[model samples]
Target: MALNLTLKPFERIVVNGCMMRNGGRKTTLTIENRADIIRETDLLKPEAAATPVRAAYFLIQSALIYPDRRDALTKSAQQQLAKLATVFTPQLARHVFEAANNVSMGEYFTALRELRPLMKRELEVLGPAGLDPTSPDELPRIPT
Candidate 1:
């Protein structure tokens, strides 16, 4: 039995990451096409993964809009970064700054890098709450 599939515009179907621009048309996937997509996607994955800091930075870009909450998130992200700082090199620092800068969280990034060792040493004395990291979902909510 043969099956027919329809895709809408802006719809993305990634068989191997060769992103078929579904301009409201049906495109057949061949072995070569699938392989090309996969190879390209694989090559792009690392660059994609590197953008999280940029994302975080953008998320925190409106820091002035939510000073207290931004401050809290900054503090938490910094703490996490600090804990991992000893293992993080200057290259990692650059990446973090790049990401932070993308979201205007440069100050937070700087603070985290500076306080990494202190935060790590104080981890033992800190409570579980202090050790717990805040996720975006845990951010302060605004009433509708």
Candidate 2:
């Protein structure tokens, strides 16, 4: 006799340290901190909002990259996030890019690391970091 094994659509499977599963399934995990989410999504802001996002991005990125600077970096990121919230609408801002409540810190950090390159590229394209709401020159110059 032969037997067949079937898997549920949302069943969790762990292989080689990675979890595989379908979407829309809730888990018991809880993420108590919002910093991780902010760090990951801040990197994808458009050129216009790049300055503040860049500040937040580097602050968080440095924290992840250097243990000694973690506290300082976290503080800096918090400041930048506050500034960002004041300047842009919630829907248009990158400040809201946070991990879901169930996301783990390790997973959040890994995702941030993966997003670093794209963030760097966006910053380069944006140029001359530092938020200046009143400076018309801060606008990116496109080739004529």
Candidate 3:
């Protein structure tokens, strides 16, 4: 099995913690093997991680990016999730808790998959950090 993707000029991606960017023209990439690849649009900037769930997701990404600190990051994620439990829907909460467990067990890829739905549900519930939903200009973009 393989993954094929097309990138616009200057689009970026992270493969095995290595950041890569496309050149002037649009390019297609064929990933023939398993690799940790995160598209730039999906990159969660640390500064933008304001909510607990967002922070947890960012921490999970950090665990992947900094293997040397995976344990520490996983611990932080677990603590953050404890705080977020109060606000999470039952289903979302289940996924997050499972993700935390996956992290603790050193199953990072599984943890990441579990956290994706957590992030999505967080946005649907909270509507982007601190933005006022009534204000059209103060919108947020949730990466898919």
Candidate 4:
């Protein structure tokens, strides 16, 4: 099976750990093999993984993109998922579990897709950290 992706001008994408930027025009990509691909706009940065679910997904992404730290990343991801598994809603829990399972089974991209639901909404799954992932910014800051 082949997947067709159309990228707009200046669009950036990451495929199997390679970051590719389209030229100054619309371009289409045909992926014929099982590969990981994410648009630049959809790329979750580590700092931007402010929510627990986002953090969990970031861990999986890091592991997949940076093989040098796979073990450490996987361990952290597993721990976070384990903590979340016991406290989240059944639906969210299922996604977390499935994502974790996918990560463990070396299906990193699928794992990220599985976590989409949890990352989209404001949630209240608290663990030892007791951080509020849903709280809005108390004060806006000007980035340096």
Q: Where does model 2 exceed 4 Å of error?
A: 1-50, 97-144
Weakest ten-residue segment in model 2 by summed lDDT: 95-104
Q: Identify the runs in model 4 with alpha carbons over 4 angstroms from their true place.
A: 123-144
What is the Cα root-mean-square deviation between model 4 and the actual structure?
6.5
Candidate No. with top TM-score: 4
Displacement of the residue 36 alpha carbon in candidate 2, Å: 11
Candidate 3's residue-wise lDDT over 14-72, tens digit each? 87878889999999999998776777787677666666666777777777666666667
Give all TM-scores, in the order shown: 0.25, 0.37, 0.69, 0.77
RMSD of each candidate?
14.5, 13.8, 6.5, 6.5
lDDT of each: 0.38, 0.42, 0.71, 0.74
**lDDT per residue, candidate 1, 45-124, as tens digits?**
21221222322332333232334465665554444344444544675565554434433434432433333343343444
For candidate 3, the C-alpha RMSD (Å) to the true structure equals: 6.5
**lDDT, residue 55, model 1:** 23
lDDT of 1 at 60: 34
Return the lDDT, model 2, position 14.
31
Clashing pairs in 3: none
Q: Give the Å error, residue 111, model 2.
A: 8.3
**Clash-forming residue pairs, model 1:** 16-37, 16-38, 18-37, 57-103, 58-103
